[model samples]
Target: MTEFIPRPDQPASTSRMPSPLVTMIVAGAVLSLCMGLRQSLGLFLQPMRAELGVSASAFGFALALQNLTWGLAQPVIGMFGDRYGPRPVLVVCGFLYSAGLLLMALGGPTIGLNIGAGVLSGVGIAGCGFGLVLGAVSRSVPPEKRVQAVGAVSAVGSLATLVIAPVCQAIIENDGWQAAALSFAAVAATIGVIALFIGGKPAPAKDHSAVASNTRQAVGEAIRHPGFVAMTLAFFACGFQLQFITVHLPTYLGICGVSTEIGAIALGVIGIANAVGSYVTGRLGTRYRPKQLLALIYLLRTVAITAFVWFPVSAFSTLAFAAIMGLLWLGVVPLVSGTVARIFGLQHFNTLFGIVFLSHQIGGFAGAWLGGVSYDLTGSYMTAWVSMALVGLGAFVLQWSMDDRDRPAPGIKDSLLGTS
Candidate 1:
């Protein structure tokens, strides 16, 4: 049998991969559950804070821990997904996610919130979120189509936000935050079903049996690569920009005298807009350099944030800002993952991407937590908002500095998945 030279991590039994559309759908559905649940949690901020009798800073810190832990766990979870495939990781993490929500509903002390919302849910997100899904979808597609596939998968999350945010608001209004959290938990627990349908596998190294060695080598090389390092720094800015808005936009709008209902609607508008933006960005990613696109996206975000803060806060402004921000939202995710795949190949793509995503989570921690802290101390979010724009400028510079050209290293080699 002629050897298959250009395999992008298909299952071992077949030289060719499974259907890209099927893999994308499965990954997208799972992401819908994971991302949608997180999106709705912003609505819980005021309610939970009021009930818990905590300052915004304290509550925000707990959520910051969620970002922190998620970033910390990403590489480990990616390792598991790379070693054993995403199914087991997804199944286990989905249950962990449910348990975390249930614990949060129990409503004991601050420690419980940290344990539930911070640690457990963070780990859960690491396993079930972008790195795992994007890696799977990337491996299932042709090299030419990788960014588009990843973007389509990301758009599902945005679509979920559009659909689930309203539904979550309705549930919270009718049932209570506890019930809402439990309901979201149930949605996450169902991700196992989608995991079963997801296609593709870890890329086989020259020595197929040496999975562990291959993983370590891939990780080591990626960490040392200048392009990967620059990409990670750029990603940190993306996380910081996104989390501040996603987690606190509802609360911020409410402070601006916007009704909670309107705030929720604005978030949904962001979702619908993001759905379009992510897809369009993905298509553009194929036509343009991912790094350059990312830099441009950051520039756009800086401008959007500037306009949003400068304008008078109102129903129209809130929705318009969200719609504009939504288009930029998650557009970077697929591009980041695609750039990783394009430069490195499918071998250990999950783990490599996870490591890069860790930087984003750290920024998430700073963005979400600091926004609250700044608001509590200064009585406005101005400090954090201004800071976010500054960081966006920094991110654009770092992305511009990245060298996407492939260079051989100890562990990073020519891609087996190269398009002939």
Candidate 2:
């Protein structure tokens, strides 16, 4: 029943900051580089298995570990961004991301894959990923424009897969997976330079702002809010469905007798649709309740999954499925982040989003790891796919029934009403 109300003293927008367009562009670049490499890892799985003799489960576990690491590190990294600034966090994460890819390329099966892909890249992504970037964008824009700005950044960020996936696949086919990874690492290294233009530091919250006095209170309030709880739990399904497909879809297509090239093309199609979807979702958020839109996305995802699994596999179906999934992909981001901003304000935006994102990563861990485990155990991905669809359905129900009313921060005077 409780939700956060905006502080009256809070500025409608930040002053002396870079133009909103510049900020969103820089944020998109950071996300694109970070997410592009992370999302495209599936392309390396089969080749790695073939060359290094690693089992599917091992690779899955590594990716699961990666997601776990990213989740575990996100809150801490987000806090750092909130207190100091996002710039330093992005720079350091870029280096780590580049190093992780290099190690994955050169380290071979056991050590390289585990440390590079799992721990290092995971940590890298935690800082440079959506939470920090979206928080920065939200802080710079007006309350009314926040969701749209977040959507634009997300849409641009999704475009990375359009170019990265196909290029990586090409490199893998011609040279080797290692070569493709090395190329990814090189691209990742650019993130640090991009960070220079992001922003200097988090703007200080005004004295009369309705925000929590400290990080502890902000996190505590978020945990106690029922809507936040539902959102976090529902995010688990998002992670599960997405991670499973990203890590296993290529392999799944292969089992159905589809060529690897088709899988690559399919991911590219998802990227294209994801951009359009993210932008449209952002625009829709302005006119609709985000919770309802979120529920719809989950429902549609479930339908798409059911159809994909129930029908025959072919190039057309695969591409069409990818497009549907892509349209649904990353759309949750703007909604979830926008909801958080609406409910809590921007004082600790990244930290709060990061906590919620932890649930998503946990689901990602299960989805990625379980998909591989199921395949190894039953020799098919049917169980994992079914499980993902079930989770999405559950998410739809929970999201639909969630309470999204604004709960004012306790002890703050009623006079202190809008966002800081």
Candidate 3:
């Protein structure tokens, strides 16, 4: 009898899956730090504008630039992560992130702020944010747990928003915005070190099907697929709606005669809700069509926004909206990431997902920049908010139309639990 052995590229990933707990924890921690830093940038706009005498639009443009740059760089960085592993990419980008924060501190409102916070930080986010971390964690697990892995990491990262938003607000309130930025920078510097422990060991292959496919062919197929196009379009709306709210909510609150502190807390609330919702999202994806779940998520978002915008502004309504919107917040991640992974396989997950994320950041750019421009023009965020609600409907429609059939993965179940 001849013994069959797998090659290095297809080594027993399923059997060798390092501790899923470790992957979740470490990747989650990295996401916590990176997301905490990235999402908290909005809290600075008021102080920075007041100190530097720049219009709301100008500050928004800087943030918009950051989104655009992050989107543009993610594919390249993701390719690096796919080829060389995530650790090296994360290690280098961690330094860049720290430097970007420090530059924001040193430069304040100058053009350097755009370069530091927008350009450099955006690039760093591409390397260290969910684009890389989710994939890394997913890679550490067996095929069965891949969706759960991404969801778990996303939930963990969402927890950071719950904790970090208040911290950013508190820091900005007392120690000042620069202090918060500097503190986050210091935290980001530790990500590379932390990445060492996360999802480094892949599980042994559980089956013969865990093969490495050609990255180019995968990319080409995905690009040509209508489902992938729909996925990207929906994700772009996700970016636009999320960034518009994250970056402008503080100012939006002020326009509504509400306190900015409330906005901060709202962000935190959204994070907490998302943390919970994302976990369920992963589980639900296993049992239901991912496209249906995505459509539902966007529909919920649409409902939440429409209700919030139509009602009178009050603390209770705002908080209620936050809680609802938060649930809708990150539920999209696992679905998007898992869908792509399922469609194309994990061999080129980082790059393929990164392309999807690039579409997202383009939406983020418009979302963040437009809120400011709209506010400056009309003295309110009504336009931006309303536009977001409409976009949510479009996303809902697009997601519903996508092909949700699971491709063949030797041991994996092809049909969702509820589907034929």
Candidate 4:
């Protein structure tokens, strides 16, 4: 019998590495543009509803659909990004996102807010948001540095929120809401072009048996892992709190007789603090275990929410809540993604993590929609705030119970199922 021989062109390394700074910069710029566009949407809610004569629940439903659609599409998008490359996915996402905005601008009244603003925008976000960019970043970075890279990317979005929210408010003031929407569409289109530059390089093919096996095993193993399940559940609460606060906080404040300017400022403060928090967490992740950090962050959020509920409504309290909560906001992104990589290996990080994030978005939909529903039903936002506090505490407990060392490193265990 003749011996089998491997092809000369076969790849030696399983990983496709890029220059760290270059990847980070590209990821940051794209994420910033995407987030800036997203953050600006809150500015439109009141104006859009007023002009269209839609109920708050109708607008809420649209946003809820957007979150739901984005969550549902994440896993599929991750599969494509993992199989092909981030470039094509990013390009497509950019186009979809731009189109979604354009449709929203055009279909302001005819089809109702839910179809255009909710469904289209949600689909667009699924294509262009952190899900795709983080997948690419996860693939490009080394295992040890994956968490920091994710944190860095997440920080860019927070920074964009800080800067862009104010800029958007200014534009709405000067140009009117419609023009601001059009302007945002233009900026979103520009981001698509930038994504072309960042994600243009093709991922090199690999033939490593170990890497292939690990990728194949990752999904099933992660699904069965209690730590991963707990993390996913905890992340749902994080999403719920984040989306509820980001989407409805302005309106909630307005009900309390706060000015629009102050509301926008409160959001901007959160964004700024979030940027700082993400950076600090990312840096700390390099030296510490991310699981403990995640638990602590969630615990802080619990305390923050409780205080916000109990305290009297004042400028100081509002700003303080925004600052403290923002600091804890998105600090989990780096740690969660980093921990996934550490436990499962980078070969299938995108697919596995995408599933986890999908759960987060589901919670986001519930939080955003319920905030409006509860307010409309009771004529107050107290219920939503209380729910957020409860969820935050639950998240802290679930995160604390997760053991980081449950899963063995890739190739160290013979079978993925038997290791546990």
Q: Kindly give the stretch of ten consecutive residues in candidate 2 with the minimal lDDT sum.
A: 1-10
TM-score of each: 0.91, 0.95, 0.90, 0.90
Number of the candidate with higher TM-score, 2 or 4: 2
Candidate 4, 87: how far from true, in Å?
0.9
Model-by-model lDDT, in order? 0.80, 0.88, 0.79, 0.75
In candidate 3, what are the lDDT values of residues 128-225, reduced to their tens digit? 88877887776666566666778878888888787778888899889887788788788878987888765443432233223434566557767777
Off by over 4 Å in 1: 1-18, 199-213, 410-420
Residue 89 displacement in candidate 2 (angstroms): 0.7
Worst 10 residues of 4 by lDDT: 1-10
After superposition, candidate 3 runs with Cα above 4 Å error: 1-17, 199-214, 406-420
* Residues 173-269, model 2: lDDT tens digits: 9999989989999998999899889877856754333446788988887887899999999999999999998999999999999999999998888
* Per-model RMSD to reference: 4.9, 3.0, 6.6, 6.8
Each prediction's number of clashing residue pairs: 0, 10, 12, 0
How far residue 408's Cα lies from its native spot in candidate 2, in Å, is 2.7
lDDT of 1 by residue, 1-420 (tens): 111122233322213335767778888888888887777778888877777776777767878899999999998998887777777788788888878877777755476578888898899888889988887777666677888888888988778888788888888889888888888778878886667777545445322223324677777777777999999998998889888887888889988999999878987898889889999988888777788888989999999999999989999988889889999998999889887876667667778888898999999999989999998999999999999999999999999878876655632233333322
The digit string of per-residue lDDT tens for model 4 on 1-420 reads 122121122221324445556667777888877766775576677777677776666666677778888888887887777677777887778777777777777776545356666676676677677776776676665555666778888887777777777777788788777777777777778777877755443354332223445455657778777899899999999889988887788787777777777777888898888888998898788777677788899889988888887878677788899999989988998888877766665556567778898989999999889988998899988898889988888888989888766455444365433453
Lowest lDDT sum, 10 consecutive residues, model 3, at 1-10
Q: How far in Å is the alpha carbon of 404 misplaced in model 4?
A: 1.7
